[model samples]
Target: MQDQFDLDVFGNYLFIFCGGSRNKYNALHWDGDGFILLYKRLKSGVIQVIQWPRSREDLRMVSQQELRWLLEGLSIEQPKAIKKAKTGYFH
Candidate 1:
């Protein structure tokens, strides 16, 4: 992640995952004073796929709730109920 992203170019938030038995998760951010790098590794479980963007040009937007779930070792993608439109013909 450090090699791939720069704060001035990419923005303040970045997340990186190192997959394996010794899985690692990294987050980089810019504080007023300097850069703050956070790292976490699960002792027993692996972090589910963060679903990174498919291409270099593509971007993935994650909600605060989703980010919280990820840090808790939970799946970010979950099924949600679809609201049906109120039954009335459009004039």
Candidate 2:
């Protein structure tokens, strides 16, 4: 049970699982002090999972930095876009 999620109030987390099939995945969630579950599947194709480190296996504990990287598709090897200030949130 490898997970990439944040425990911070402003951060989100994701859970990775390998149960269903090649086209689907399950994400058990953590809502603040509680737990929840989320599921995802490709509508017209299969989902691809990247190779993760073969060490961390606890879902309840994941780093915020790692979760940020996963959710934003940002990594050391990839060229990430310049982060600009968020605007136009409301009208």
Compared with the true structure, what per-residue lDDT tens digits does model 1 show for residues 3-56? 453225245665555455535677767666777788888777777765655444
Candidate 1 clash total?
Answer: 0
Q: In model 2, what lDDT does residue 80 have?
A: 66
User: Poorest 10 consecutive residues of model 1 by lDDT?
Assistant: 1-10
Worst 10 residues of 2 by lDDT: 1-10
- Which residue pairs clash within candidate 2? 5-13
The local distance difference test score of each candidate is 0.63, 0.49
Clashing pairs in 1: none
Against the correct fold, how does model 2 do in TM-score? Answer: 0.40
Q: Residues 1-91, candidate 2: write the lDDT tens digits.
A: 3243323422355555644454556665677777676655555554433554355442334456544444443442335645446787765
